[model samples]
Target: MLLFDQNGWDSRTYLGGWTTLGATADAVSPSTGERLGSFAVATAADVETAVDLAVSAQKTWAATSPEEKAAVLRKAAALLEGTTEVLATWLADEAGSAHGKAAFEAGLVASEFHLAAATAMMPYGQLLRTGRPRTSLARRVPVGVVGVISPFNFPAILAARSIAPALALGNAVVLKPDPRTTVAGGLYLAAILEEAGLPPGVLNVVPGGADVGAALVDEPRVPVISFTGSTPAGRAIGARAGELLKRAHLELGGNNALVVLEDADVEAAASAGAWGSFLHQGQICMTTGRHLVHESLYDRYVELLAEKASRLSAGPPASGAPLGPIIDAGQRDKVHSIVTRSVDAGARVLAGGSYDALFYSPTVLADVAPGQAAFEEEIFGPVASVTSFSTTEELVQLVNSSPYGLSLGILAGDAYAAFELADRMRSGIVHINDQTVDDEAQAPFGGVGASGTGVRFGGHEANIEAFTETQWVTIQGSIATYPF
Candidate 1:
């Protein structure tokens, strides 16, 4: 029973130079169902305090050189590497990430900072190639204060993904992490930023539920909002931001597809499908929700995939299980609802659909046809809906039928053919020989339609552009000799 040290790691809110302690509820460990610790639920007043601080600090931060911001990010990354074990342990307990996945997230969080560090020296603005005597230049300026709202799925990595780039681009942030991940996500996350010499009021953390999140969004001082969560919530935020005419950056839900062509190697494809659909219990937005294979390869692929899924079990992070429980009972039940509804609608469970508390089995539903909830919706659990398609046109139609356009995966022997088909995918990202669940820090990562809004986040130049407002400057060579 690894309980938290109540004296040190208890409920708290980080306000630049100060910390506040008082929680509305306790954060429970998903694996053991034990109380990990409590976290302070930020009230509307708390949110006001944070926004006021950010508004004051951002003016100073935006004036600093990019190199100076990069130094702080690098120092934060070094501090993260030193605190890996402790953070990983708490993340596993609070978020229920498996040991390997938890460790991977910790490393990836550190790497996210490095990627942002590389962008520090890159061009923040561009000069036009006007050959005229007068000079014309364009500069990218920060979008003032950024209000960040992150989900609990990959607490450290997801928060870092948005925070690193925003900070690198000279934006002060007021972050509101989900209550479930307050300690693992907000506390240490902000502590590192503060210790790395972030000036007072540059970064603030208010851990709470919907009210705190809503307050942050409603505040007028924070002109930009970066949120990662479900589409329903995102839509609401989008509407509010629109009413306020504020800039918004959203990375939302996904119901991705994995297409296996007739010529694909069934064994390899099955292995990839298993890992993509089951990693972190399919909590990732990029997780494959549908597996569509050509009729000739469907049966064999299903067999191999089921066999692989059967070997996995959800347990504590240190238990060497391949996965872990869902975030909590409500989320666990939501996943099971899809499984039950699919079964009631005539889908056959080929592998596993049983649940012991929050640990949902890696379920595979066979012959899941159209109109089924599992087939049409985002079954964001360790569940894979397997079905077959005949022609290439049918495959394309099936994949594009869904509203989501986040990512696509294609497996085929003919490399060019795979790329050709992938090009037509409605998704923002497509992989010829890999699973849909993939990301790199340097590549542009975002989606079209409901999957995301605004520009992508990565180490690319686009990220800098996303968080910045552009201004064009022109120098007049001589006072007008024209008419007057």
Candidate 2:
């Protein structure tokens, strides 16, 4: 059965099942400015109710057998794989993702579910050595309920990464997806899991604005918070979570760097750079925000990058354009402002620095320096700022200068040299011959500094750590006599 249908958009936000709140908001298509449908607008009270229900359901879910949990997750994965095209269409219509990016995200959601299913079957504890005549072991247990706040970009993947693992590990989740992408990010997952035999209250979707998110973070019932969004918002969540003595897994913003060594092929390097910067209109957190090329090939690299940027046209994803519209006019204006300010600061726009409505042209800026806005800040747009470096030390300095250290990429003829360079870089993820915008379901994905709490998501180990708590238990034949 289809998890989502156009007619199902009404009362899309699922607290336990498809239900409506006191208020509702329209889910508008960013690419066409058409109303897809309305979704429930969850209030602070709604968030509290969702968390309360999750807490009640988590106990029974935690008592379930690992095999049963695994079976449910695997079924969910199969369902997602079967309906990839349907979800991809939602992604394109709701989040303005290009067809290719939308399809990739749809596939990624299924992959995440598959990975979580495997995690459910993995060993949950380890035996410990003890000196006394006692059996001691450490076992993993659920963290009660997890509060997940996900962004619009790669909505399904980001939310599914945290949600699937948490549920597989027997913890219920109360997810708050960005209001702009409620259908794809929130309701879609809820629908699939419910159909796949997920019990009521095990996964809750409450789509709303900032107030709703703050309520989820502040709820005392939620002992863990998994947030993916801007750096500023992450900082606030981290601080509040700390005040509540709760664990927070934050995957925040990034101004990732792509370094082209002197020996690198200029054409290949340019291709990687363009893909990293322009894919999904650079809405990705791991987008290549800065390009640091060696002085020898810098001019040619810039020229090729400019040509690539100029060739890409921004329009609706249905138009078969490689680049899609910005999420809204406000975001388009923010991107254009950064480009204009960078140009004002002496950086030349080599190809594009323009927009029509919400569609922004893929822009390339050359001679971007340390102090320039485009180079220093995380531009969540299809804008590539190129700079030249003469030495390894200079390249390292350039890469580390940014406040964000999410992802780094190095392209060089010598793999050993690239590895050594990666060692010196401060980023959480490094690619030797690839771009910054990349991820795998099995990799430990996160960043340091403003990017996120380091290594908090992905892989079996990280997922277990993020969603479960370790408890030490001792066993004996009977109650032993103890001196009191």
Candidate 3:
């Protein structure tokens, strides 16, 4: 079956099944400045109703056999793989993804479903040793219901990373996707899973603004909240979830670094740096925001990077451009403000410092220092800030200065030296020879410090820990007498 259509585009939010209540909002194409379609805008009451249904559905779903759960997940994966073209189109129009990025994201989402299906058949728990004559064991159980809040940058992969595993492990999910990407992030999954034989109420999609997100977090029925967004918003959700005594898995923002040692090849390093900073318009959490090079090679490195950046053009993904528009005008303005402030702070834009409509050009800034806006802040745009470091101590200090530590990358001629430098880094993920923008369906993905809570979101072990609870049970053949 086809994944999307005109009718599905106009459908309401998925609560148990598709239904509308009250107001609706339009999903506009960020690249084209045209209305894609309208979806039901869920209110606080809709979030409450969705969570209640999830709670009710979790009881039956948790008791389902592992084989049955795996079958459904595998079917979902097959369905996703079959409709990659359609899904990519939705991603391009809604999330402003380039054609290649959109296709890669669709493929990754399908792979996550396959990995989650494998998790269903894996070992759940272990047996424990006991001194007394009794049987003892620890088994995994579902967390009942999970609340997922995904961002627009990576609408498909981010939402599917949590939702697929949560469902495969028998926990129902209530997802609130960003209004900007409601169809690709929220309703598309609902439609695919529904067609793949998933039971009603097992997965609910609500598309709305911050009010809907607050309602999802405040709902007592939701014990787990999985959020992927900005650092400020994550801190607010983490604090509120703590007050409610709930588990909040936050994958927040990052200002990652890419370091080039003196012995490294400036030409090759420049290419890697460009890919890290310009991929997906540099909107990813692990995007390389800071480029640190040895003082001897800084000028040449900056020149090559500027030349590379100038070759890239931004426009609608349908126009086959390498770089696409930012998510919206507000985001485009934020990018421009950061670049402008950095220029005023003595940083020079070597390549691009201009924008037209929603499309911002790939920009390279030189002479950026520790205190500059481009160097310190997480500029979620196609902007690369280049700085020079004199010694190893300065390099260490420069990389660790940022409060956000999501991913780090180092390039050098000597492998041992690069490994030594990587040991001093504080980020959760590190790369020795490659840039920082990377993710795998089976790898543990998250960050430390201001980036997020250390709890990760992928792999077999991490997924089990994130979505399930462990229970200890003991049994005896006969009833024993007890004194009261």
Candidate 4:
């Protein structure tokens, strides 16, 4: 098992001679208290070395033809598909995602890899009509080196989304996988990419903590920093990137709202909302943590939502469990703290509002005050807090009042009603009669305002953002066309 950093030639063939370095994070298995391998807490110097390597390697890699890049990415997709089980196992053990979900997340890595290959085939720049004394053509160039700072919640998929786009665009990448889940998932992936013929140092994965991230983002050679994590952290990173004059793409935290109108199918809405809100213990950025239900349906919806949450079974990720533990003790405490505050502030705990050991049962709270912690904060665990509103105007006001604008979901039988709800909700992505977390690889996924600064995915928009550039190509048909 190659640990920490890999040197390509020797590391790929060697299996068991890996050595651990730096202080290990308290990476407890969320399902059980099993102590997984610790993540190396990389220092500033480690980050500097990784960024330097990426910058050095990117110069040559960017010069390669797009066809060559496509071939390499295609190979990577195939390799990832072949190793799904191994990758899935790592994801389950480290991130506490259920086995089936872990497999799904790992599979997305391959899907995105394929998507990147497709994106590589896309033509860069465009020919414009010009009546010219001189002819000119423009082309986009790589931004050189990119620093990817990923989160622990969905390590494999989030890291792959950012890193794949960077590499596919011909920029070298320095990936800092979330320390919590680095060993079980990302390390395996770094090996696969290396074996799939990605140039040495073209893509490098460095496992580390917060200090390393600061170092990576601050480096002068790292021109772009892409981050997916909490709102506060995203702010800090955006500030640093601004200081360095580096391009920054942030997919930050969310307090997603799911509104169910009186006309909606109650049973369908209940099921979809439950799954959306509670999946991965509600740790996803797009998870619908808050529900603003129509007053007419609020009581019944809360009852059903609470019952569903109570019935959710939590266990080890390998057991084909429906739910697993929160990522770590810190997250577990954060969830608990939110619930405690809600209760103290007079919110009624409907069901399963307590935590034991690594597991916190799917929790549902009702009658929460608008300004309470549960109402205002991003309770990013398997906890659902519902509040009722009487009018469409009230629902819109409540949903838009939040600082977050990541995703908004609505459940309603009337298409027009759903459309109106979507128009009013303050979110970057909106779902109709569905879960907020449902995202297609081809569609752009991101948020606005504090939620994030930009969006990403593999498609025309992604290409424009990741690989395309704009240049005004001007030409003069005659010397008189040029004015002093």
Candidate 5:
């Protein structure tokens, strides 16, 4: 039987000790809108129970050595690899990912787990000299239970980014995944962790929506919230976390740009831009939504970009086109509206711009002006907007004008020139000779301004530090006498 049979489902909430059936949420295929099955929807009360259990179990888990934790992560990585095919199928059905994209997401899950395992056993902590006579040492300690809320775009991999590291650092996690892709996000997640020998109550899965998420956030026991979703929702979480004085690590929206400089190879830039703009139907946060070209190469770059985008088709994964449908009608309609409005506002559509069913053709819009939606907003779809700039200053202004500062890409002839241009761009990650949609498990991945909450998902000191707190310990060689 298929792992994600549409006929029926056996979804349930994974509590600390056992799985329990609860309120039902019907899962539907994004590609066809067909009912996949009804799975349990966890409530606020259920969230409380899960958090309580996690808090109880965190004590024992925290005492476990980093090596032991790393071993568990390695085992989980192997188990995840074993379920690659099934995981890919579930993601394709629920998240509207093409076969290639689904496979990539599944593979990334295991690789990120391995990286996090290595990070767990690495040397951390330091002995500090504060110009004091006492010997001082800073040690890392777990930050209690962590609440992870993931979006549907990259359900398996994005959530694993936070979960693996948190567990590796001796902190338990309570996950609340998006309702749209619950199976790939939450249902089997706990099972895999348990199978990897994770102690019960160390990790729990509660599939829920907004209210459930709010409950998780409000629960004072859960000190840290790692969320990946829209910018508006991110702001809300940030505000609430601020009110409660809790830590929030958010990986939110992006309106990234790929700039084609005068010295760039038009064909190469166009190919990279097309892939960055249309991959996974532009559902990725770092998808290049805007294309800024130098006046010298604007026309040629636009022409090549249109040609490359036109060759791609949007359909099922088996169709062989690198593109696929949007997550659902709502997202599809939004993309269609952006294209239509851009066209009405004098932006010319050089390639396909229509949709049949849930599939939206890859579109390339040229002569996009300032007022156009495609030029102004995060059109999270298979659409790319092209505009021209005379100088690097103008290009920087155009890229930084967007309220979102997620990422930017520069296609320059010389590496030094590319890095120079990249340094001026106000994004978290700047790519030279590559597209903006790139992520690694060991990089400081996140955005600035509206893109994220100034917190990184992985890489360097921040990723490991996010899950643990530093304690300053000082000891004296001899006991001091106090005068009464």
Candidate 6:
């Protein structure tokens, strides 16, 4: 609800709504380190209020039939689809993303809703064919109140990914979004859900920072904690949830690796690598950070990638812009420092060693050695570091040695070669001849190790993980009459 001037001036707003200044930081524009509006920090009392409302509403919500839940979710999807243009514009401005990227993310949010709707109404467990002497059945039931803590990057889509499934299963959600981009996506979502006729308190939005989130997660009324953030943060939340005996679904950070074999198409591999590393300024958890190319083709692929990355222009978030600024100044400086240290450690900056505040040129580095910060950490920025490997064995060993295992992308010609490399990669999801960030609605999208603990996105994975619980209906007659 706030806009800044072109001369890097600031503004303020007192929009009359249920706003919570939970983030505690000013909502500064990435393009111009200028304050757009004051982000109020939500207090523990506010979190208690939100959780109480959700807990009060959950009983009725859980009693509603699955078909009713599906109807509401589907209608919400329709409303979201209708508001793509406005939603994308606001999202781009708030999050500093390209218009096209924002629109695509909005569209995906709508699609996830529809998919979750279908999951809500789908038939439950199947009956096994047993002897006529006994009868047995099973059912999938919904868990009660769920607490959703979403991150700033991909705010809309990621929030939708968790909320839709939780709602579809008839659980009231208390969502504590990252204060930085809460207005970017959550407001439109709440409006659409309201238009879809969801009852009050079923999807409560509590805008706040870490303290608010901590309160919600630790509350006894919140039975499930669904978190998407850094690994350290996730571990902290998980431990607290464990103390309370609450279920936790965590999606953490990653340092993904891209492996290119000698037989791979150099041009195609380079293109895929650049797209995976530069898209969203490499903020995506699945974005490729480490590049392992066979020595035979490493030089050629590096050259191609450098040329391609140098040509990418950084522009405003308006329509037709190829790309936009990073999410914030802190992230920009982190990336800059990592790149600078890598250069000092003998890595050569192949291209893009300059920056304009929030915009770091798409960067590529070569001659990267093991244990360097750029090679060791998850540089979630528009940067990729290339390393050489003498054989597929060496490549696999190097990638597996990292403490993190999220997603890995392997580039090779022969099907067997790709499969072989993928078989040895120590990651949850593996992509062959494709970019690592390419996600499908029906696939189990998540990570392993430092990346995350459970699956996300809209699919059987979400349905089974969100609502379905195993129940055994046993017959004593079966055990007594069974043949010995």
Q: What RMSD, rounded to one decimal, does every model reach? A: 2.4, 1.0, 1.1, 3.5, 2.1, 4.7
Candidate 3, overall lDDT?
0.93
Where's the lowest-lDDT run of ten residues in candidate 4?
9-18
Q: How close is every model to the real structure, measured as TM-score?
A: 0.96, 0.99, 0.98, 0.91, 0.96, 0.90
**Per-residue CA lDDT of candidate 4, range 1-484, in tens?**
2422334322221111122445446555767778755545556876676666777788888888889998988998998898888778778887888877788888888888888888777776666666655666665667888888898888888888877767887888887878777755456667777777788778776666788888888889888888899999999999988987888888899999988888988788888889888998898999988888888988899999998998887777766668888887888899999999999999999888887777789988999868998889998899888899998888888998899999888889897768875876678898888878876667888899889985755465574585434555665566654365
Model 2: lDDT of residue 87: 93
Residue 123 lDDT, candidate 5, scale 0-100:
72
For candidate 6, write residues 405-458 as lDDT tens digits.
888888889857788758778887888887678665677877888888757554
Q: Please give the lDDT score at residue 470 for candidate 2.
A: 98
Error of 2 at 297 (Å): 0.5
- Looking at model 2, the pairs that clash are none
Give the alpha carbon lDDT tens digit for every residue of 219-294 in model 3.
Answer: 9989999999999999999999999999999999999999999999889999999999999999999999999999
Candidate 4 segments whose C-alpha is farther than 4 A from its true place? 1-28, 38-41, 467-484
Our model 3 lands, by Cα RMSD against the true structure, at: 1.1
Stretches of candidate 5 exceeding 4 Å from the true structure: 1-9, 130-133
Task: Decide which is better by lDDT, 3 or 5.
Answer: 3
Between candidates 3 and 4, the TM-score winner: 3
**Given candidate 4, what's the lDDT at residue 306?**
90
Candidate 1 structure quality by residue, lDDT tens digits, 1-484:
1222355446566786546545556888989889877766788889998888988998898888878988999998998898888778878899999878888888888888888877776776667877767778898888888889999998888788888888888888899988888777777777778778788888888888898898989999888888999999999998999999997788998989999999999999999999889999999999999999999999999989889888888877768888898998899888999999999999889889999988899988888888899988887899999989999899999999889889889999997999988777888888889999887778888888889873468765767877788999888768747676
Clashing pairs in 1: none
Better of 4 and 6 by TM-score: 4
